[model samples]
Target: MGMGGMRRQGSDFEPEFFRIFRSIEDQQKRSAWLQAEGMLAAAPMLRARGLPLAADDPGEVSLEAERAAAEQQMLEALVRSGVPFLLAGPSLAAWTLYPEPGRRPRESMDLMIHARAVNDARAILRDEDFVPDPRGATRTESAQAWRRSKASVQLSIRLRWDFCDHPILNRRFSIAGLQAKSVVIEKPVAGLRALGVEHATLYSALRWVDAVHERFRLVDLFDQDLRWRMLGKEKLAELALLARQRGVAGILAEHLGMARRVFGTPVSTELLHSLKQSGNHERSGSLLGAGRGRMRYHLLGALYGRGLRVRGRHLFSLISPG
Candidate 1:
């Protein structure tokens, strides 16, 4: 189902927000889960509407300062190690959403750095006591035990990836490529770096499609919506052109439509119409559109990519298996 069809009656967030909310029968368990997701602030609103509530719910505890310090520590370590990185996904989104992470806490910070720096980044994070949770079988992990599911966003494992969703998306896109074409945004923290208006907007849409198609997580849509609202019309025009150049504008338009419909985010309708006009050139709807088997994701990838090269490069991306 598209996001609209997935909504349960009471959820103001993603449908899985309520799907997981309703699944827990115990009040404190629900409260704890909400606290962990950073949604405990909604407790009063939910209770006023006569939903279940725990009378003894704890006082609001903000994790922003602590998270900021931890993020600073890790980034400093990476920079010291000479590894260039981009604060990616939730970590990148946190800069604008500062002092409030909205409905979900960034249980893990995301980093997408040069492919050459993966091992060094992994080691630096480990030295800082950030345990690396390396996952490669995106093509093989089961649905019920899928580690990235909405219900299991945090497993008390405190897991973090050395590279931001790299195993899944880095296979398709690259940090160096993004850095080459992208403008840099202001560093939120001392060592923090990210793509500026144009590139950040493009990448977030790309990630949004991958996350939703895999049924992996709704939080990514929140990230995309965050980027969309920050990029006003002119920059978005730049994004639309960049996306078409990248061959993802068509599929991105459809997913951006989902972000708009669900979050009431201010994505331009005219821009979306322009994006959809790409038609056959848009690669994702055929390549990674939802429900295709894993084998097809690998096969179709070789057929096209942003800024196509000779077939050999595409074939290398398919078989090299990051």
Candidate 2:
């Protein structure tokens, strides 16, 4: 209980997610902002207060409908062509991870497949009018931007052969290992699957820590608390080992501490202590006690060579926000 209390007394690196969330004093305006940004990850909390949502414009609703239909067509094409894949990211997670999903609309959806079958999968998407994003290859996988030839489907599909897109970070997890633990989807979207609970916990933690943002990714970070709760105690013992083995224990532990600090995620006190005590550099107050910015740029860089280019890209964006 002592450890579970927020660790940072006065840290400048603290996330402003809830600070900004609470600052939105008017419930009406807050709901509108959430809807416009498609940050439906906050739906359960909003519903608890019985807040009325700002309605969508009819044009936007029509566009969303078209996108949904296009997405379904893309999925049907994949299934019909027998392209085995796993539905990933917020597209599925947002819909299924929480007690009541808000079906957050996505301009892009992610799916993973075997490297050998990437072309085959692309062909199926092409047949359905999707085309390779002209922006070209990613560090880890190819992308298929949904062709907005007529109605502006407002969709992009990522064809991933691996989970972590970072070249340096690719060693963290495996497509094969995650796929082995994947759970099948049965309704609304058939022939699709998502990461299992243990995997979701790790993946979400990784994303939380690895992410670099101008504005804190409020919805995704909010997801950390939810997924952490879903993880429960039975498998709690394995998370530290998994995090350690995958080389993310220190960084993930640090971010988990941040989550506990910020969100009051309702995880057991022992969890944070266990992660820090997992016998990584975390125990030495190296990564675990570091500030969020320091941990992101320095600890992760030294551990996995992740920061130089990423930091440069972020700086460039800051300098040129056009």
Q: How do all models score by TM-score?
A: 0.63, 0.72
Best by TM-score: 2
- Show how many residue pairs clash in every candidate, following the order shown: 0, 0
Which whole-number lDDT from 0 to 100 does residue 158 have in model 2? Answer: 72
Model 1 reaches what TM-score against the true structure? 0.63
Tens digits of per-residue lDDT, candidate 1, 1-322, equal 2454322223354344455677899877887776654556445534654557665233353344455455555566766677776655566666554434333345555555665666666565556544434442222211011122232123212222321222233334556665565444455445456666565665666555444224344555656766776676677777777667767777677777766665556666676777888835644556444554444554554443333442344455456645
Candidate 2 lDDT, 159-213, residue by residue in tens = 7676664434555667777788788776446766777766676666655543343
Native-referenced Cα lDDT, model 1? 0.52
The runs of at least 3 residues in candidate 2 whose Cα sits more than 4 Å from the true structure, single-residue gaps closed, are: 1-20, 27-29, 32-37, 40-45, 49-69, 98-102, 134-150, 209-216, 282-322
How many Å off is the CA of 231 in candidate 1?
1.5
The alpha-carbon root-mean-square deviation between model 2 and the true structure, to one decimal in Å, is: 6.2
